[model samples]
Target chain A: PNADAYGAARERLRNQARPAGSLGILEEVGARLAGIFGTIDVRLDRKIVITCAGDHGICAEGVSRFPQKVTPQMVYNFVGGGASVSVLARHAGAEVRVADLGVDWDFAPDLPIYHKKVRKGTANFAAVPAMTREEAVRSIEAGIEIVDELTAEGPVHLIGTGDMGIGNTSPSTAIIAAYSNIPVPELTGRGTGIDDDGLRKKIAAIEKGLALHRPDPKDPVGVLEKVGGLEIGGLAGLVIGAAAHGIPVVCDGLIATAGALIACELAPSARPYLFAGHNSVEVGHRYMLEHLGLQPLLHLEFRLGEGTGAALAMTLMDAATRILAEIKTFAEVGINDAQ
Target chain B: PNADAYGAARERLRNQARPAGSLGILEEVGARLAGIFGTIDVRLDRKIVITCAGDHGICAEGVSRFPQKVTPQMVYNFVGGGASVSVLARHAGAEVRVADLGVDWDFAPDLPIYHKKVRKGTANFAAVPAMTREEAVRSIEAGIEIVDELTAEGPVHLIGTGDMGIGNTSPSTAIIAAYSNIPVPELTGRGTGIDDDGLRKKIAAIEKGLALHRPDPKDPVGVLEKVGGLEIGGLAGLVIGAAAHGIPVVCDGLIATAGALIACELAPSARPYLFAGHNSVEVGHRYMLEHLGLQPLLHLEFRLGEGTGAALAMTLMDAATRILAEIKTFAEVGINDAQ
Candidate 1:
């Protein structure tokens, strides 16, 4: 992000017809937007939410409430405009793009879904590496290529990270655990509303995976291959791709944020272009957000991730940029700020 | 609120193609909106934000950073589409309605503002009662009348409470201090960027006024007469009026919530129709919302209370209602919830 542009935007915001810094987080958001767009004239008119789906073999441990078949089912629901993110993205006036990273199902050829399959599904990290290093790199590249293809079609102003996978939260939480000394149990949460026994099983599985893999935080690709899902890798690529194209990325809840953590590790410059969409109910969501130094825009206590948080947050980004563009300065309004 | 309608709405929400209660706070908001509208079909279209401007003689006590003249100036800014709320309301697709309850400045008839001024301003509560009980009732009735008139023109779907009054926070905090045993200074905050000395003076003034007025929580009207701005009283009426008309009211920051407190105390039945738009940075805002048993939708830390928070919340209300109206059910998509 351009610091000079951010500073200039802040000065402009301070002069708007309101008390200085009274818009609170919005003022910071508007300035950051100006920095990202490299101008005060920021337009988030063309927005898209990328909902990436994959399957997790970790579901074999009974870590989630739903079966792995639900992943492909949800992708169809997303395309059919029936999912939560579908309605929300439509409400936000953004198009929803469904991508299959490695779901363990074959979608029909006529379906309007991106067929970017890296593998059938990730291997259970508790017993083996989630994916090969080559597959992990390929997954990220697929995401980057998606963004490139979309922007090639038009000037894509913003992108939102979304995910659909059974037991995906297991890998998301493990990613956070690898970055911090926080206990696996502390970072783990009940995905899709699990019982106490299921939660305990989840914690033990993550602990086992961590113990076996001993993933290094330094080599993010190695970590991704060892314990990350294909969709997560794609989402990380989405973040890096968005930053590379100078477009802002609104990262959804825990899973998308896990992807973001990996993206930032690989390319620290992408950190400046990202917005934590909301503080989810997942215990590790806020912890991971703090690690990334991103302040979430919404606190709706949302736990369902399909870019819903990102879609809602896009409205705020629109408001912030519109504020910078539409609101007149105190001088234009002939109002004395000191008075 | 209609309990039967709310339950029915919740049932429908559960039948939609998502996890049961996964949308979290939004699911509740959608159901409550259905209850308010008395059906599963909720329409938040044709939204309006009523910004009632008044003045406080309490400004003479040095409790605020800006002069009382800034109140009328802001009303002009709001009318001219140059204020923070103006841009935000426009962004949210809501119309801005500026009303004068007790502003000191006089305006020509050509200006597009509601001419409902009860008095030039209220008396300093630190020295005497803010208004006669008769004037307090009139202010609230003025708010109710405005809502009635607007709805009479068309089927109004939603209303948001906003206020513009210098030293208004002093009286607002006083209203809360009357109900709670919390320290007066704890409830008081820097209004419009006041210095520590100004804050000390504000707290001292509120404490002095509460001691002098001895406002009772049971007699809400008496409390308003003793320690409320005309805009606050008007906003209280707005909540009551919105409830009587079955239109949801999105209550904005400290001053707006202070008015809502008075409204709920006077008519407990109206409490169900109110939504705390966003938790402001004001010290007493959340405390007052808690007292009203209201949960804010957004946590943007917004302090510019010209219906700005309410306008932003209207979009969420739209999204929540649209979720119920647009998203497909499991049966419609031929998907089994158990899977």
Candidate 2:
């Protein structure tokens, strides 16, 4: 958060063994992390990805084009190792575990479940508060518990939060508006490939939710309890935990950005550990990125959730760290002049 | 290339564990290589990069913004491991070696050198032929010899071509125009970030060369003798050798594209093994890509040519091969969805 640290990081990156400003924004990210950690030899070791799957109560409002069943189906896809995030996790060589934060489905009692299902999904947040404040805190504590368990084994190097909830973007937009103080219409967008008509209905639903909640922006927890989804609350906890434990966190698209906005409100210093993976097609994503003053690594018009963009951006982070760690300095190579 | 074999290769890729068209252009490339090598599983082993360093006589015609000395200076950068290609090759995990194809420098005999200099770089083709037929043959033979030596040691999986020559774009434009039959002015671009005035002069110089050479498009060898740089001729040989030896070759940006165009002419079947790495900012690159019917994997607006694009693209090839070799099929994993 110190502007001086940002300047020093940029200076260190400029001094790396390459042309000035050649690596582009990746150079700045590496430098910023180096300055934050107060070490030139910064490495990402305990990479953690927490995939939170839930069902959106807003699905009852008929907002998403896809059936709400797709949420559970995609979670099965993740568990069955057939989802994009599964393949991406293999590529990133990161540890991934799923959280059943608040999906409607009830699992067998002895099954391997990481987090609690606070309720069988929320009431239609369009007409009422998604969950009670107690339920929201319980979900946040679920995420905090995961981070605590993972970091107890070792220091988490980087944390990535992903979500799998259909019709959740309406809730996300409302949360983004409450935290960022942006207009509701500007923060609304077509989630899961909704048409213009669907987008209009979605925006109107979010406006109703905002009216019902009347969230106070000064209190982060109060704002989340008013408008946020369970996954958003869990992600906020993950972000706070990673920052508290001195691990960097890379936030995925719009939904994750909403979580990060709350995390920043809770602990302002968490913004430094956060890297925006890519700009999502969601209008609210642009608002969140602009509010956070973070630029994404790639812009291939990707809007898929499930942390695919974050996984791909991790490749760039690996590359940057390798360059900083492996490249021989001018002194080591001993090149005289331009010869 | 056998059309049947190519079809079979495509079938194998489509039958892979992932979704159809998920790998994009790489799926086609891997399939085509499978056809070339007559194997279902293709591995990228013994990757080789042939860096052709030369001096363009057009530098004498004031075609380049940088001095002629930068060509040899960059060659030293490549050899000393400071150039972009050097870092890219380190990332690609490939073996890179430089060839002094036609630089205007006398070197010690004991130095590690591939002495295939053709009259200390070509004559200014705007005024005269870039190289005589005999000299062109010599340069091509030198490139083939390098490939033969490398492949003789073991199976050479991927061959990438890079070049270092000041004002080489002048020769590259002439070669591209001769091959693509496009207008010289339309194919010429500002090489090495030339200004508007420099670009106009470069175009004028290429037009003059086209007037002087009047190359026959049908005769690939004759066209090379008339207008191609020594590095282009060498690249043609590299491509030919890779095809004859049944090795996949990855071609870099515009200059390498010119070499690939010549190779495709010399042996039409060789086109199957050629992979365009990335689209460069060079004006002739799009025409060259069109002629080859190859779509590059990445479009990063990269103009810095050192075979760095090819080297970076090699990472994708590596990823594809790893999937082919390591990933378990549905049947192997005991999943009923096996194709």
Candidate 3:
């Protein structure tokens, strides 16, 4: 990050025709964007939320409220532009790119989605590793490839991470447990609103998976191979790929931030590129964002995932860029500064 | 608010394709809108932020970082659509109506703004009541009249409160001190980034103003006459008027919420009409919103009191309405709900 450029942006904002720092965090966010882009002016005209869809093998453990088949169904919804992410992304003037990461389904050549399936589905982590380390690497590499392909059309100003997979949060909780000292119960939540019995089952399943795999926190790839889903790996790759290209990325809810965890671990420099789209009701999400040292842009008690929060925040980022680049300075407007 | 209609809206949302209560607080907010409108389906087409601009007597207390003249200057900016509120309210698809309530300057008659000035300015609150009770009553009634005139074109679906007055936080802190038991120091913050010395002076000024007037907590009108700005009274009237018409109102920040406190106290029914736009960094705002039992829509650390945050939240409320009103239910989509 360009500290000098960040300071310059903040100085320019301070000279705007308003009370000093009255814009509050929006000013700081704009300044940070300036530093990230290495310029005083930033523009976010081209925005997109890349949602990766995969199936969790943990469904075999009865950890999810929805059936695993719902994964492919939601992908169909995304392709039809009928999902929450699609609606919100459109509202934010952002496009949605659906990635078929590992949804236990095959598609025809005419499908309106990205074809990057790593496997049919992860192995049921309650009994075995979700995928081999090579598969984990491949899943994330798919994400990097997708990002590069998308940016080739033009400069993708901002990207948000999204996911649509049933039973995904079970693995996300397990990933948080491996990386942080937070307990499984403290990290677990009723993903998509499960009843009490399902919650108990999910807690038990995660404890079993953790005990069996004993994944290493330091080895993010190993953790992904052991307990993470393929879409999670892909989402992580999206973050790393965006960082490698010097583009800022936003991640939505617990599912997306779980991928952020892997990406940051794999490439610690990705920290500066990642933005927490919103704080989810999921208990582990707070720990994940805190561990990553990210303050989410929104806190709406959201847990539906699908990059909805990230898409909503993209609009604010665009507004922030406008505030930084469009507003007249005190010198330009001949307005006196605060005495 | 119609509890029956609120329950009906919740039921309708529960039947949506997504899981029950997936939208979280947004679902509740939309349901409240439904109850306020006495319908299961609510539409927020005509939206506006009625910003009351005025001068504060507390300017004589040296409690602010900016000059009192900035009040009218910023109002000019509002008319030019160059202020933050104008930009954000436009972005949120809400109209901005600036009402001059004791602004200490006379706008040209042809200027596109509301002429509701209660007085040239209030008496200096450091040594006397900010306004006579009659002036206070007139200022608030002006707000009510504006709401009626604005909605006369058509029913306004949502109304937001905004204020532009230098050193207005002094009277706001005094209002909280009168009603709440929270100590002034704990509830006081440096509004608009005052230095340590300015913050001290603001606290001392509030303490002195409170001791001098001894404003009765039970008589909200008396409290406004003693310590509130004319624009604050106007904002309070906006809330009461919105409730009288069964419309939901969003309040910007500290100054706006100070008005909300008075409105809710005067007519407890207005509680249902009030939505916190965002929690201000101003310490007194916490007690004000808590006293109103209102949860803010955003927590952007925004302290620029121009209905900017309320404008931003208007977009979210629109999104929430879309989510509740759009999106195919599971049966319509032929998708299975959680098992």
Candidate 4:
């Protein structure tokens, strides 16, 4: 953090003609943005959310309502600019980049998505380990390369994380349960508003994955290799890569937060680089956030995990940055401060 | 609310390619806005926040950190477009209309504010009623006329409530305590970050007003006449007028919520027409929202009573409306539903 810039931002806020501290959390948001950029005049441009599309073989267990085919179809929708993340990213003045992580289906060579498929899809963790350790490492490196390539044009200030894989939440729950002693039922939710029967199946499947993989709780990489999905590993690498380059990563919802948890477990130093986009309606979301010690910026009760929440939060963060940079001080505006 | 429009909006959302209810509470927000406008296609072209500026007479009890003189000066700040609400409202693409609900000091006759001063200020409520019943009725009417005149050309679709008054939280705490049997200390917060001594004084002041006025909890108008500020009265009327015109009123933090409580208490039908912008950091805000059966859209830890929170929420509401009206359904987009 730049003490000088933080001081300058606080001074400007103090003299903004309204009562001091009246802006509440916004004043802190402004000061923090200033600290992030190491300057009082912080501005965000050319923001992008990387939506990694993949598939979950665990969908065959009837854990999710939708078929795994929806993943590739949603990737097509992303290419045609019709997906939720597409609309919301554009709405928030940010671009979207949909990358193929490990979907089971193959795309045409001419498709616009960058192909870094570690495999067709992860092995159903309920039956076996999801991926080999080497494959997991390669997934992380692939995410790092994606961010590095995107920022090669110019430094991207904010990076949002999104994933599209049906039944991925089952694996997400497994990963959290593998590390923490939280019960599967406590960490499970209606992934797609499932019925009581479906939820029971989902919880059973998660427990089966834990029993089959026997993931080492002390080893984050082993846990990812055993129980986590490819997109999850990629998101973890994206967070680590962003921290390596001194940029902030805005995490979407539960799946992305699972990836973030893996990243934080892998490297505790990467924790500060992550920002929660919104509190998810998923029952396990509060547990994950409490584990992270982060608060989300919005609460619209969004259950979709498409980086849509991240896109909206990018706009609010931009607004906070603008306030820190644009508003005039008492000395500049010739207004008396409240006494 | 229009049932047909609500149904249409839901149908559109259901077929929008996302999972049903994946948008969660935003789906309800969209449907409500559609119902409010009597169309599935809802648009807000001209939105305005009425920032009612006033002063409280209870400051004489040594309850606030700042003097009462800061009220008009901040009003000047609002007019000059330099206050937090001014900057945030403009940032959210909403116009601000600052009116003189009752400031202790007078402005120039041709100043760029509506001169609807109910009185120089309220009487010292520690010893007497704040205003007579006639003055209370006139203040409410003045607020109604302000909205009526502003929407004379075309009805404003959204109205935001903001207030400026020193020592006003004292009265707000008193209002909440009057209706609910909650203790004052449990309901009160450090308004404007008052010190321990100032907080003690504020609680003592509220207790004095309650002891002296003995305002009836059942009689909201009588309570306002005895204990509430003129701006609070005006805000209640603004809410009523917005409801009368079939517009959505986005309620801000604590002080504005105090006014909203009065409005809902006066006309029960007005309750559905109001949207909570954010939950206030003030502890009583929870009690108030629970009483109204309303959940705020955002929880950014904002306690600023300016329509700033409302402005931010207006942006979100606009986003929800656009998603409802503009997004293509499954038939239009040629996309299969997740199921």
Candidate 5:
């Protein structure tokens, strides 16, 4: 990111017809866009949201209210343009691209989703590692590969990270615990609306997995291998790849922010290109966002994490960039600002 | 608002493919739209934002950072489609309609603005009533008359209220003070980036206005005549008119919401039709929203009051209504929810 461009963009925004600093986060977004693109004349016409789906082994412990099969079903709904994210992306004038990272079910060869499965699924982390370290690396590479394929076709202005897996939030919580001194109970939440017993089981399952793996915070990849979901890893790669390409990535909800936290840990340069789409209802989401030093753009209490939040916020990004590029300065509008 | 339709919408939303309460504020907005439109199938295709421009006599007290001349200057910016609200409303697929209720300057007859001037401007509220009770009523009636003329052309799906006036915050704070026992100091804020001395002067002006007027809370018309600006009264009528026509009205920041507060007091039924666009940095705005039992849709800390906040959140309303009408139910998608 270019600091000079960021400063220049801020100066430009200060001269817009409105009072300085009145647009709030939109102004910040404009400056950040200028920083990322190294120019204030950046266009974000090609917007895309990639929702990665992969089953979590933690569902065997009854950690989620929905069945694991819902993962593939939702993926079908996504491709069929019937899910929340699909509807929202269309409303935002952005395209929805689905990816199969490590779902247990086999999709047909003609399915529209990206065929990037690393394994059927990972082993249960309560009794064994979620995946070998190599598999974790593969999942991250898959996301980067998707970015490469996308950029080859066209200049992608923005990418929003989304996730789908029934028990995914459990691993998201576990990953947050790996990085912070916060207890598992504090980081745990009702994934897919779990009951009291389901909540207790989720907490215990994370505690047991953490105790067995004892994942080191210094080794982010090792921690992901021990407890993170494949979709989470893929999302982390999406963040890293977006930053590598100088594209802004909006991370949705708890699991997506967990992915962002890992991406920031792996590559500190990715931090500036990331935007937390919203503050999710999940308690652990705030912790993960704080860990990443990111402020969410919206606080609508969204917990449906199929990139719906990102899709909604992409419109604000549109507003921000337009304010930077379109709105005439005070001098151009002939308004005396000395008053 | 139709309670039965609202209940039916909730039931329908629960049956959607995602988990029952996952969409959060969007879901609430969906159900609220159902209530207002008296059906689950509400379409917000024709949207409009009415920005009422007036001048404040309270500028005589050195209560603002911007000069009073800027009110007409911004009115020109709004009509010329260069202001923040104009750009954002275009982005949100809404039309910008400028209404000159009591601006201090005269706009040309061919400027393409609503010719509904009630007066040149309000009197200095710190020393005298802002307007006569009859003029206040006339200003509000002008707003309702705009709605009537708009509906005559075609049905308006949504109407957003905005305001443009110099030192209008002084009168807004005075209005809030008239309704609440909260200290004037706590309710006061630096409108348009005033310094510490300007802030002190603003607080003193509002305090003096309220002490002299002693506006009766029960008589909302007298309250507007005593302490509110003409644009504020006009916005109050916009809210009332929107509710009368069963259209959802998204109220922008401080000045817009003060109008909503007065409208709710005048016509208790208008309360259900109001949606706060975003929480403003202005302290008294939240107090007024709370008084009307309204929750803001966005919390972007936006303080630019030319309906920019309303324009941004209007897209969310579009998404919400689309979610309610478009997403397939679990049964329709053949996804078993009993699992």
Candidate 6:
């Protein structure tokens, strides 16, 4: 299986002449790929970041602290290059494309919007399922179509998934609990700095959805249709698509973590392709990371949810790859040390 | 007179339209110059880093954990692009030039070594004064001449000072206490991860030197000649030279701190040109920072020398300059806001 390829790659990278485990989590990334590809000569140059933007009907219930108008404001901020992710992408030298999967507002026809909205946003999942089964598959296929287009450009070395949706974390937490098999309390977090009372309300909403759709863990796509947001379902599709195509993907904070867990449940080998960027201050983040058996690199108490963490983590990846490819061997440098 | 310019510049940078105290110590760097140049439109394109290397005769007394050979080995590491400061300079887009002011070993003729040795390092400053008055002046003048040549290429915006000398901390501690009018114990620190017992011995050595010199703090150069290492004297000259030419200089950890204290004593205006990089983990670092009335930005418990800290701090300067120069005005963006 693909897991064997990742295991081999990790062994080869670790066996290279250096201090053992000196590279830390970077070594895990390289090893994971080596096992995925079944070869030691792995390369990571082409980077593609997919940002999914949607709107939540829960906003109508006054669940979020920020006005729903701020969603479009931030989308414009992304376009105007003022968002944190914009600077981070510039720092990482990665190409980014934004998609509007289910935003309530309309964007220009020529603005790279995917136009994959399923009813202009989800129905409040606390009240009912966000989308029907067929609609979830359609959104996921939209993400798959984007990956197919990106793969045509070149060998897609890495994929990063980011989401922008007001109140989407509510659905994401529900989907994570359904797939991760953790209790709703363990999977819920203070999304967007919600107050203690708001957190309690959010947890209650997730538990209500869990009661309505008792999803089977064995069928992740079925579970996603039962509870996940359109963006989360789309991200899950992207992860599975990248792994099926043998491309590595780095997952950003909590929302992306939920997507990865769903992808892994769908195809166990998909776990080999994913790297967790950082642990967010979100309470659900620890449960997600633990479920995935992942250890993130930086822990600076960051809770920003714009894929900024993934972009910063990419810098460390660049450093790791440069060191792996560029450092001279002992024989090449005339050093007498034994490997 | 120069100190007045520094104070004025510090005020203007603080008044820029942004979050109050958001840019941290970088605000002071900009403001210090606003006072001097009478404008916030400042430039920092050309940078010069002076690395002064010597050998401490106290190395012969087994005071340091690293061998005296490490002094030259690190010099080679700097030249070979393997040292931490080398990578940091490349990151900061700054130019680095090394000066072999004094080392016991003679290097190859074409090795880019600056022939400014002061009697193959110094007599054990623990046992005697490190250098004579004539030798100290010669070393300082050599540094001045180097900066003059470097500034001829362009308008030097920033200057940085670093050094390489084993057992140099003994002399540095003596200089810091004598100049700051602090007790020897208050000014001593583990220079390079020295043990608790070793630190006690270092403080004893500094106390002994203070007893021998009893230097007059008013006569900065005389104080330097009596207690300073060759590298420290050279750095003091570089600081003064950069200020005499109206270029801002960033002072590194402890050794550079000693040099800045000397520069301020010699030409009070030069304090405006000096930016302290970080509060190093050395026990004396906080004292040096307090004496200079500076607040360092980054605090990662770094004690490594070789100007690495200063090089990293330069990145923040780049960020600050970009914020000042590149961020759009509310009026320009057509946003109505109270300024």
The per-prediction tally of clashing pairs is 0, 0, 0, 0, 0, 18
User: What is the C-alpha lDDT profile of model 2 across A1-339, one tens digit per residue?
Assistant: 445655666665555433345444556777766765666566776576778777788876667876766665556666666565666666666766677887878766654446567777777877777888898887777777888888887776778888778787887888778867778888887676677888788888888888887988887777777777888888888888877777778888888878888888888978888888767777888888888888876553556667756765676666666555555444455433421
Residue lDDT tens for model 5, A195-267: 9999999999999999999999999899899999898889999999999898999999998888888889999
lDDT of 2 by residue, B34-113 (tens): 67766657777678777888888887777877677667766666777766677777767887778888888875665455
Model 3 superposed RMSD (Cα): 2.0
True contacts kept of 5: 0.72
- Per residue, candidate 1 scores C-alpha lDDT tens digits across B1-339 of 788999999988888876777788888999999888888888777999999999998998999888788888889889998788888899888999999999999988789998999999999999999999999999999999999999989998989999999889889999988877688988887878899889888888898999888999999999999999999999999999999998899999999999999999999989888998999999988789888888899999888889999999999999889877777788888778543
Candidate 3 C-alpha lDDT tens digits along B1-339: 888988888887887666677767788888888888888667788999988988987888888888888888888888877778877887788899899998998789888888999998888887999999999999889988988888788889999899999888888888998989677899898888788998888888888888898899999999999988899999999999998888899998999999889888888978878898888888889888888888888888888888888988898888777676666567656686543
Ten-residue stretch with the least lDDT total in model 1 chain A: A330-339
- Estimate, for each residue in A5-104, the C-alpha lDDT of model 4 and write its tens digit: 7788898888766567766666777787787688877777878899887788787778998877878888888788877788788778899988888999
Question: Where is model 3 more than 4 Å wrong at Cα?
Answer: A1-5, B1-5, B37-43
> Once model 2 is optimally superposed onto the true structure by TM-score, how far is the C-alpha of residue A305 displaced, in angstroms?
4.1
For candidate 1, give the lDDT of residue A179: 93
TM-score against truth, every candidate: 0.99, 0.77, 0.96, 0.95, 0.98, 0.66
Ranking by DockQ: 1, 5, 3, 4, 2, 6
Which of candidates 1 and 4 reaches a greater lDDT?
1
lDDT of each: 0.91, 0.74, 0.87, 0.83, 0.91, 0.68
Per-model C-alpha RMSD: 1.1, 5.3, 2.0, 2.0, 1.2, 7.4
Residue A261 Cα positional deviation in candidate 1, in Å, after optimal superposition: 0.4
- Chain A only, candidate 4, TM-score: 0.95
Off by over 4 Å in 6: A1-49, A58-65, A80-84, A113-119, A122-145, A157-163, A166-305, A312-339, B1-50, B61-66, B80-88, B107-119, B122-147, B157-163, B166-229, B232-339
Interface RMSD of 4: 2.0
Whole-structure CA lDDT of model 4:
0.83
Docking class of 3: medium
Q: What is the lDDT for B162 in model 4?
A: 85
Q: What is the C-alpha lDDT profile of model 5 across B1-339, one tens digit per residue?
A: 999999999998999999889999889999999999999999999999999999989899999888889999998888889889998999899999999999999789999888889999999999999999999999999989989888999989999999999989889988898898789999998888999999999999899988898999999999999999999989999999999998899999999999999899999988889998999999999999889887898888888898989998999999999899888888877897535
